[model samples]
Target: MSPEFATRYNRWRYNLYAPVYDRVVAAFFAPRRRRAIELLAPAPDERLLLLGAGTGLDLDYLSGCRQLTAIDVSDGMLARLRRRADRLGLAVDVRVMDGQRLDFPDACFDAVILHLILAVIPDPVACLREVERVLKPGGRAVVFDKFLPDGGHAGWARVAANWLTRLIATDINRQLGVIVGHTTLHIEHEESAGMGGFFRIALLRK
Candidate 1:
């Protein structure tokens, strides 16, 4: 499929998945999400962007933040996120925007959070380039997602599994290093998050 078609399909898929998303994903990803935010270590007043923010699962962890903006292509997901922020009594600037093409000014944010986005977003290279463009010099971004191990080849079995994975939710064969390499972002730290290192959390600097 074309990138545009893939993006549209993702938007539709996530919107359809929005209602039960929290119940299905919240518990399993909570710890990794928390760890990713902790790695970011944002200041209270810093401007932070949560790219591909879905259902605001990360809002609870960011209650102390003053300037928080979240963008997602799925309005259904952002609607739930807004409600979540309201319950947390935090003011968040939430917009329905594409991750590959962020509608933000250059060097405007102190930190960017990419939780489970790389594997799901179409054209991960474009998404990372946008992240690099929006980050200030020396700014950091924390990425938490499933990636094929660095330097490990994706065998036929893994490649075949990715076909189904991509159709329903996310692509399992995406490589973090290869994606980040498309931009100037540098990986500062990386650690295994879960599923025998299938999921990873990494800190990237721009």
Candidate 2:
């Protein structure tokens, strides 16, 4: 909600990075993404909300889901999502909306997934509020991302890596648990791992 947050995010993400988005993010984290998504273990009938879905790479991971709503800040990214969805005969309700200001009714989704999206936003806490608002009572969201590693992290080395990567991709150093603390969701489970010890997946309840 800060001044120009949506404009800045969309302009950079779409105009500056759309052409290379897939290659860069994929080259860096495809294998890791696959592993994380598999761990999510979504059921077929679940009403899924995918935040910052970016081009629907996660679509391939949703084998059994019946309904899916894909949201991204970039219209270009949503375009890619639509084309891919059309090619695959999958129908995802694509919305060109910021995660922090999702325009949906309460209790709209059975589950939500924020995959490497929080850190890219100006205020990840705002995005979490939107997630908590739309999710049904007792529903939960699963997240997969790389944050500044804490215990097993390489300390200064990891910090350097974060800054360097930010020039290209979003940094992997956000404490999503802390951001979601104000919401009713309880952090049910947390896991961490990666090539550089920089991945975290948290399951949360509303």
Candidate 3:
């Protein structure tokens, strides 16, 4: 599918799922989300960006951050995220923006939190490249998502299943190595986050 088509389709899908997104995803991924941000270790005065920030699930753990900005394509999701941030008394700059096309200036962020977006975004490489561009030298980005292990191959069945998964939710067969290989960011640390090793939390340095 064309990147434009995939991006629009996923945005519509997530907007439709926004109302119940927390119910279905929040509880299950809460621990992992917190863990990913913990690895990010945002300082009190740090400028942090939450790319693909869905329903503001990461806001609670990021209250200490002074400059917090979040961007997502789904306005429905961002609306909920704004509400969550308000309730938590955290100041957040929430905008409806595409992950693949960040509007921010280069090398502006101290850290970036990418939770559960790599596999879901239409162009993971473009998104990662943007992440790398916007990060300050020595800036950190913490990622939490399910990625096919390095050098791992997806069986025919899994590849077939990926078609439907990509259409509706995420691309399960995407590899972190393949995506990150296109950018200058280096993987600093990686460890199992959940789903019995299916999901991983990784720290990348730019």
Clashes of each: 0, 2, 0
Residue ranges of candidate 2 with Cα displaced over 4 Å: 1-3, 149-167
What is candidate 2's lDDT per residue for 1-206, written digit by digit as tens? Answer: 45266447554656567767788776666666676667666788879999988888878778678799998878878888888788888878998887888989999898987888876766778889889999999888888887654433446876788776655567666666567776878888777756554677778889
lDDT of residue 81 for candidate 2: 84
- Encode model 3's per-residue lDDT on 115-145: one tens digit a residue: 9899999899999999999999999999899
RMSD, model 3, all Cα superposed?
A: 0.9
lDDT, candidates in the order shown: 0.94, 0.77, 0.91
Measured by TM-score, the strongest candidate is 1
State candidate 3's TM-score: 0.98
Candidate 1 vs candidate 3: the TM-score winner is 1
Pick by lDDT: 1 or 3, better one: 1
Q: What's the lDDT for candidate 1?
A: 0.94
What is the lDDT for 24 in model 2? 70
Put down candidate 1 lDDT per residue, 42-65, tens digits, no spaces.
999999999999999999899889
Measured against the true structure, the TM-scores of the candidates, in listed sequence, are 0.99, 0.85, 0.98
